[model samples]
Target: MKKAITKRLATIILAFMILTLCLNYVLQVHNARNDMYLDAKNKFWQINQILKQNEKETEQVKEDLKANCLIRAKAAAYILQYRPEITEDQEEMEKIARLLQVDEFHLFDKEGTLYAGSEPKYFGLNFTSGEQMQFFLPMLKDRELELCQDITPNTAEQKLMQYAAVWREDGEGIVQIGLEPDRVLESMKKNELSYIFSLVTADSGTTIYAIDPGTYQILGCTDGELAGKSITDVGVDPGTKMNQGFSARVNGEDSYCVFTDGDSVILGITESNRGLYKDVNSNCLLTAVYLVLISIIMIVSISKYMDYYVVRGISSVNQRLEKITKGNLDTKVEVETTPEFKELSGRINLMVDSLLDTTNKLTKILEAARVPIGVYEYNKDMKRVMATGRVADILMLTEEEARELLLDHVLFEKKLEDIRLHPVTGGKDVYRLPGEREHFIRMNTFSNANSILGIIIDVTEDMVEKQHIEKERDIDLLTGLYSRRAFYRKMEELFKAPEELGHAVILMADADNLKKVNDDYGHENGDRYLQGIAVILRSCKAEKQVLARISGDEFVVFLYQCRDREVLSAHIRELLLTMKGSTVELSNSKEIPVRFSVGCAYYPEDGRDYRELLSLSDHNMYQSKRNRER
Candidate 1:
């Protein structure tokens, strides 16, 4: 009997040892996974923080550029108004140039002939042939007071920067202020790595400037070499390297690379995955070994006692749990054993009862939740509608209709694709539904490799409000005409449209002596004079045209299908003559004569499109005014 008992006891001890080892391994694996997940979360948070900081710095830089440009534009306007003769006066030009803090200030005649600048040699040099000149022509034609151009000068010595505002004084020719590119970059530098800086053409991704001042690395080709090269044309190898993980070692150490394609910027950070994994493995191994040792000692010491008091009791409790798991929650464990076993069985039965009650309550709550909730299985070939709750009532669809809508295989498949294609975060559209309102159907997609979850929210009021806000922004509040920004938007749209059979005409008009009228009469009178000219321009338009008050006293009209320049010029001249005849009665009942200068340029004939036409017309208008003064 003693020998038989020993063999049975040995078998029990071996079983306990195996169970303890398995439990230790499971616990170690669970802890290791949790640690890795936490690490990843922390790393992602760090990246997000960096991105936010960079964005703030970039915004500050943009604000500074705007402020600087405003100051320069105002200065240029002052010089143009007070110093027309100063265009030829080198001393005056130098004084104003110093005050403006620019390398050079150039005055272009209405014909785009360089009339005067700090550099006397450039005078009379025509810029009719260059693409850069063509771009600025439209702004001048429109008499855009706050226009800015990012252009490289024809002179090789001057680097590229923004030229803000092409101003034309009543008696003076058009004046342009050149701002330094380095100054713009310097304004944006919040910290060492604040700028994701590159200089590219407005419409193309050609890297004219790509330097990291922090690293002193000419990311573009050597200075003056890659001045006009596209980002793709630069000879950086596109091959995938081994250390190209989320965080990788470059040049034998871990570092992040900020890449800019002159337009878009990307930042990549790498970490030592090998070192991370090694540390994790070591920790897990140590933890497992320690736990296993402790478990083995406990199992050996308590095997007989546990078998008598705990294991058999646990088995009985598990059998009762199995009944609960099988949907027999009414079945409870019998308490006919030792006090410890009895207590455990009682607790397990009580826990099961509580869980059942909670589950029953939850089911009732979900059933009462009237908003329709659904789950669907989506695959490449088909979309199978799986489950839905009562939220379909808001859809105004009957249960049957709702079911039919949900089950429509073709519709479901298309909707699923739409959802997959349109994300809800980061400039993505969202649809939402409010109480008993318009049925807002917003489609957005959520996805992983194998599955996707698309959520729809009905956004009825939001869409309406957004539309209203946009309309308000596009319309000018002062004169009830199209704002300058709106004009630019329309121009962009027109330029993007398919080429028509005939040419388009853009006419730029400026109110003559409006500032002098304001100074002599009052601002209210000045406003009336501007409104008067706007009325005349609006009256002259018969075709589908955009009449916009771009600035203080400047207006632009887009004329479509107009071929006769003489007819347009005659009409403009007639309007100007009428304006010269018309007078604004001020608060003191003093009549002030209203006069305006008009310039016209045709598409493809004068220049290609809006920019070129505007430039040509502006140049011509200035020339006309200059001759009139002479």
Candidate 2:
């Protein structure tokens, strides 16, 4: 009996020692993982700050380039306007072009005739003739103003140049200068800003890549092999998960990648997380070894002093602890042999019951949550663990089916693939359920070494509401056309760059007798007249044509990509003929025919912006109205 008591006491001592060592090891691991997360977060924050500063500097450089170009053009125009003799002499014009360091130089007469230029081939060209006429004629019509054109090919110079021309203060002619884009860009010296990338030091395992957002091409990188490759080619998605940083595998190693967008480019910094936990893990392993040696010493010393009187009860309690560790929390220690052992057994059982209750409550709360929450760990085999809730409903599966789908990784492979490429937080993606009901789900994700935790919320209603608001905000309620504000917005979108706009025309039209119609037939009748005109305009509009009622009596139509001016005139003529034949009868049975005065301006010939085109067309419309009055 004494020998049995000794053996049981030895077993209990060994088990306690092992449990103490294991708990210590687990605490060390948790601390190490936390430090790693902190290190990664700090690195990302630092890198993103540097990227934002570089972007701001780049934007400032762009603004300075434009400002400096304008200054140079104004100075050149001021000099040339005072000296008309240079326009008459080709030698003088060539000398002036060289002196100003301009790619091309020209002078126009008050009639917009190219009186003299460095290129003799273009000397007789009229500013009001052909496709290029609109750009220069607007200065004449607007009464002697300065103007600048975007980059375009100057066949005379055989290079791309940006043209800036100004009217002579004396109104004699216009002084025009052309700048080589390359020269202007060189003068700005944006390339010097590349040194900013070098300031971010990346160790052996880390990398920093500068990318051109416009082209998604790598401009500079710590790795020479990554240079000239697109962001995608280097395993980075330029279009995916912008602004927010993410974690993914790069070059077969886990890395944290942070992205910062500049005015013209994107900066990506990739950092490896291996070194962050290295020291902590090493120390934990050493400490665990030390604890094992100490535990062995304690086991040997305690066995000799333990007596047979307490052995049976302690063994029974130890057995229950072993069962609890193996997930048998309901098992209680049967320790009624001694009064002391009975109290100890009751306390142990109480602690285990409390732990079990807490765990069950937490599980129920997660199950009741409206948002879908999940964890995915990918190591050897991909495993997904999801909280019980709307996750199954969202996936259009029963709870059991959802678990099966996750285990198979079939239904969610695409989503998982994207997440593997780039882990997203508050990122938007659309998914179709089993019933084909599409939903917009937003995910806020947290990532560790090889695992991701996500909270998904359905935002379909929010998205629909925003779109409806935008539609209402941009449309004119009364005329069923775009509002004045929307007209300008659409024009900005359609005519983003000057080169993209080919043969565009703006037509400004006004009701000729709107005031007379209103006074004679009352305000309600005038509204009917206006609605009738809107119907006609809507009927005449083709694809991509934007028509808007900008004022009470004024309407504007932007005819996009209509190369032939005759086509525009024919359309207007047909509309007039239709209006001439049709009449609106008011409540008094009084019939009135609609008449309109229209003036048109061509793009890249008249002006580039809406203000410039509208001013010219409006002037012409008033002039036409005056002619009709005569």
The sequence of per-residue lDDT tens digits that candidate 2 reaches over residues 52-137 is 76567656654554565566667666777677666667898788778777767777887888878787877777775554445767
536-567 per-residue lDDT for model 1 (tens digits): 77776446678888888778877765556665
Worst 10 residues of 1 by lDDT: 199-208
Give the candidate number with the greatest lDDT.
2
lDDT of 2: 0.68
RMSD of each: 21.8, 21.8
State each model's CA lDDT, in order: 0.59, 0.68
